[model samples]
Target: MKKVSKAIINFDDYVERKNTDSRKWSMAGMHEMATYVDDNSIPLWVADMDYKVPTIIIEKLKKRVEHGVFGYSIPSEEYYNSIKYWNKIRNNWEIEKEWIVSTPGVVVGLNFAIKAFTAIGDGIIIQNPVYPPFKSSILNNNRVIVDNSLIDKNGLYFIDFEDLEKKASNPKNKLMIICNPHNPIGKVWTKEDLEKIGEICFRNNVILISDEIHSDLILFGNKFTTIGILNENIINNSIICTSPSKTFNIAGIPVSNIIISNEKLRMEYLNEIIKSGLKPIPSLFGAIAVESCYTLDGLEWLEEVKRNLENNYIYLKDYLKENIPKITCGHLEGTYLAWLDFKKLGYSNQVLNEKLEKEAKLVIDPGEIFGEMGTGFIRLNFACHKKILIETLERLKIVFGK
Candidate 1:
């Protein structure tokens, strides 16, 4: 509840990102970039924010850079202790240094988990219309994807518990990857919701991998319950993937903490990491950023950013309702990404892409890329200046209004 120094943190400041090698700004190599992107278009795609990270992180990195020793680096005791302190203060979860495993990124950790616990042909359950990487990691590993698609009740999403129970009960399904405060839809799984999922996965002897990258971005009075805080049995059967990337706007740092409590599973995952020829230590810069951003200082900056995101969400919903009533904006309980339903526009994905590119002159993630359930829903990143968000909404109003 402490206020950040407004002199340093300005949510309304517009920072230019073009020609900076930011993938979110540049469309090259993006999924639909070549087809729909032009140099002049504004980008609202990708999950990264447009604001600057906390000054503490920048100062720490600068101090490290001055040392001028780029030799091999390892995570120090402070790095591990910072992570432990972060979980205890922020998420109310107690953790030990022994349970922490450093990875280059959460997606990389997902692949390690897949290789470590499940066999090549084993079934891995994932909720559809979720993050695209969740499905690809399973398929790329030669594992079967069990779609426990979330039920869409109007604009809000709910878990299909019956379907989930059925899927978890399958003997072949050995693992499940859950997106807490799920992507695109932005529904934060409640404590009760997680407990139910824990019971189902635990009862079936299925190992759970909870992707909690967006756990720190909760909005609208919603709470995020870490999977490791559940029953002892459930906690023993889960792996938590966390990062400072999304919350601190430091995705380029390539660092994540994969927490595994069970000693056997921890060893198995570490074995996969070693077999992949990856050192357990994180990069020098990544280590500094992690240690700097997991403190009370970083929390203050994040609190301000969340307020800006909430305001942007309110403006987006209001703007669409008042002007472009055809498109429906889903509720955003967490994450800066907003899900907009474009089905009423009555266009195929290609046609919609063309319109969004040629008419709106904007870059946004197409819904189909997430899963079939995302066919006509586009995900828009609103973690930018209010002016940028307003410009985006104005473009949509001009294009979708007709």
Candidate 2:
């Protein structure tokens, strides 16, 4: 692997993604009102980035494709080692090989955790204005949704622990899914926060499922502490879902590693996957992509990506504050997503979304989808080239400044 300097990593270089069946682009379709937008519409909706994948991973994929025999493939020992090494080096968290369970995706692993830990009709607690899938995974598995919605004050988000404790106290509330370096709101939870939540869950007999998928994307010098590292009790009772997809822009390649330190919990989750009729092995390309993404070259690429993301956030925040004062953006501690409060504008979700689509010709994730708390807000993906983000903001000024 070649070492590339930050100066050489061209995050500003635009890569055309239109008509590529991209969920962030062409595939968003009529359901998202994307079909009605013009061809030049700026899409800042999906969690995935508009940037290209790191060159190292792409080269590795090309070589794998050249082999041309895509047969049933199992994860290699190298794959497990790569994950172990990444956890140790990147997160300062030691993880053993046996503790890792390969899943097709984080969302799939979430469903497996829901099945393994909680029974049908059991309550699953989640912090709202969270990733939409957290709610879907619980409901789709016949589990009840118990929302411990975060408290928003002056554009910042904080976990409502009292509400969380009350929700967890319910005997039927068997599980809680935590989004570390939380999506949409982009709050990188602190050690203290994790410990408090862990204690609440431990005492209430609620199994904790920590979705640390965005763990690798800590922005603006914020540190991410995994719930597994909180304490012995937390580690014993928690399952962590991690992936290289979001960090490396390889989300299309399905791969996630579910980490469970407790032997009993690990086996139960594996059994649930087997019962679901889904093989535990990831796809051939998924294995290669994960391994490639944890290498030294990959780390270097990610450093550059993080810097670019930080710059993008700063640029967007300042631009909105100066030009579109009605829109308030919260401090982005992690993730490329920016949570923008539009309540001051006093527009309904329907009208706001329509104005964005028809007037500005832009597509962003409406906050209402995250939960009712997300009403009067919108989440913007600022992980594109700086030029594209500038254009999007200009469009926003045109639409909302009226």
Best by TM-score: 1
The digit string of per-residue lDDT tens for model 2 on 290-315 reads 88888788787889899999988989
- Model 1 over residues 65-97: C-alpha lDDT tens digits? 999988988888889988998899889999999
Model 2: lDDT of residue 120: 92
lDDT for 206 (candidate 1): 97
lDDT of 2: 0.87
Error of 1 at 84 (Å): 0.8
The residue ranges of model 1 lying beyond 4 angstroms of the native Cα positions read 1-7, 32-34
All candidates' TM-scores?
0.97, 0.96
RMSD of each: 1.9, 1.9
State which candidate has the highest lDDT: 1
